[model samples]
Target chain A: MQYITSLITATAKPPPDNAAVFSRWFVNHSSWGVLMTVDGQGFPFGNVISSSDGGTGIPYFYLSTLYDPTGMNALKNSKSCFTLSETALGTCGQADPQFPKCAKIALSGDVLRELVSVEEDSKEAAFAEAALFANHPQLSGWPKGHNFTVFKLRLKNIFLVNKLAPARYVPIDDYFKAI
Target chain B: MQYITSLITATAKPPPDNAAVFSRWFVNHSSWGVLMTVDGQGFPFGNVISSSDGGTGIPYFYLSTLYDPTGMNALKNSKSCFTLSETALGTCGQADPQFPKCAKIALSGDVLRELVSVEEDSKEAAFAEAALFANHPQLSGWPKGHNFTVFKLRLKNIFLVNKLAPARYVPIDDYFKAI
Candidate 1:
């Protein structure tokens, strides 16, 4: 198989206000994104995690510090990218018949770490913890000594695809706008 | 963070009666079960493809025939695993609000090569091709040589999740039953 690896960059277009295209796609589909990072040996480690916003409209996620070797490696490496896609239903399983199984969106970019603080009294710390908890309700009862860290993807590129149309590449700025 | 590699090895389960769940979770969420192979130099390569039937109603996917560099490296070394998830609407952007944004699944197993064929008179082949083309209408006019090679995944483990539920890891066989 031929491997293609160039960072495609483009400005995000303001999606048509009435365009239910992306919204419809996200609904009747499962949302998954891949995280790419380098290990200590410098080998690329690609893993997937649940993506969500803290109910505040900003994309974030909650992951177990104990179960994420790749995430740890990513934090250590300090350089990582994510790839997310929205595909047609037929492509996944025999899920929905009314929907064509082919539309998708992939977002790939760098990762930045945001360390969680223990002090709930500090406004800054409380805000951060609240944000993290909003996306990860399971973390509400974490035992003491457990460490949690939040990271953000400094998005680099966004790939929007519909088997019905040509694929489009949007740069970071445009991606946020389109979002 | 710990990197755990788990396989979904069990008897095959019957295909889901409603293929909707499978299609929605897998095809629509194509980013969920991406195969991560490494190049000759140990660089990673990822692709999103669906598995074909293994004659048991269970879905399966395969590696490339030519032993692409990454596939070769992955085979020589140990196979790696990844997890997939998505963000809900209104949370990420002005996308689908009614649909749960967070959909996640975890898949693990070795990458293996399997032989597949399109019989000269096989209606299944025609149907599969038509389904593909209908979603990707542009491909309707493309030359056959440009098509991707098809393969099936011999599943070892499969896990799935929705915002309202805890993640469930189904043995390959059980996964079929759940469908």
Candidate 2:
């Protein structure tokens, strides 16, 4: 007797707004993202760190030389990817009720050129500088002993999952628009 | 005239537990991490994804087969690296941050194997299967139709910031112990 098997399928809807979803997802669900970069030899390297200016309303970052050698490598490589996800906690047998799994994201693009210091011409840079400092108080007294550089990500594509039911994807343009 | 250049420096205390710090940083700063992998020619490719997960105490992932071709390539090439930071935001201007950013971790390891089905006799097989199903309810009825796979990352070494950070050389045993 030949038994007929049926196949079931489900499709994920595009997020309401790519950028908005991206920003909200990053802000609401996680506090850190991995930065991936390839050395001159093309070997992949990753690092974990805290998010500076990322939140529901913002999707950008404020990279510093004192903390990121991977970003430094990214500057030199000019091509890299960033990933973020919820943490996974149960598989290893920790009693934490919260399942600490992670969703993966890959941000590939060239790091834009660095911006001048937010301290330069405070009067002229008030709006942008104030906004940055206010949102990220960790940067209050940072400029004095540190060198700052700003690089914008020329996004390529984004992938996401909520570990809920069905996973989803976000296109590059859609991601920017959502934010 | 002697010019006084005041340098404000704060000594960063290694978190009581590196694993806790790593896990916390990843959970709190999800938008900044990068998922990096090497290509067929050994070139790295990165794409940012909106990350979320089941919140398992351990870091588990449900990867989609649809758009993860590059991820497959990287896994095939060698172990991939994930990097993230918070301090880089200060000096890097949405590029990199410093200070608190002094903490960075590199999770290096290979993709051990990808499992799609759970065996009845496997360890935690029931729990693992239930967890998988719960996370992908769309596959509830059509277990056979689900194309999801669970990839195992056999962590090798966790390289922290400064290249010489004591926590940088985290062995897999240490990771397991931390939890």
Candidate 2 residues B68-110, lDDT tens each?
5544664467556544453322322343233343555555666
**lDDT digits (tens) for residues A97-143 of candidate 2:** 11222344445555443444544433323333444455456655655
Per-residue lDDT of A116-146 in model 1, one digit per residue for the tens?
4434224333453555454345555644443
Q: Rate the local accuracy (lDDT) of all candidates.
A: 0.41, 0.44
Q: Pick the candidate with the highest DockQ.
A: 2
**DockQ of each model against the real complex?**
0.12, 0.23
Among all candidates shown, the one with the greatest TM-score: 2
Model 2 residue B172 lDDT score:
62
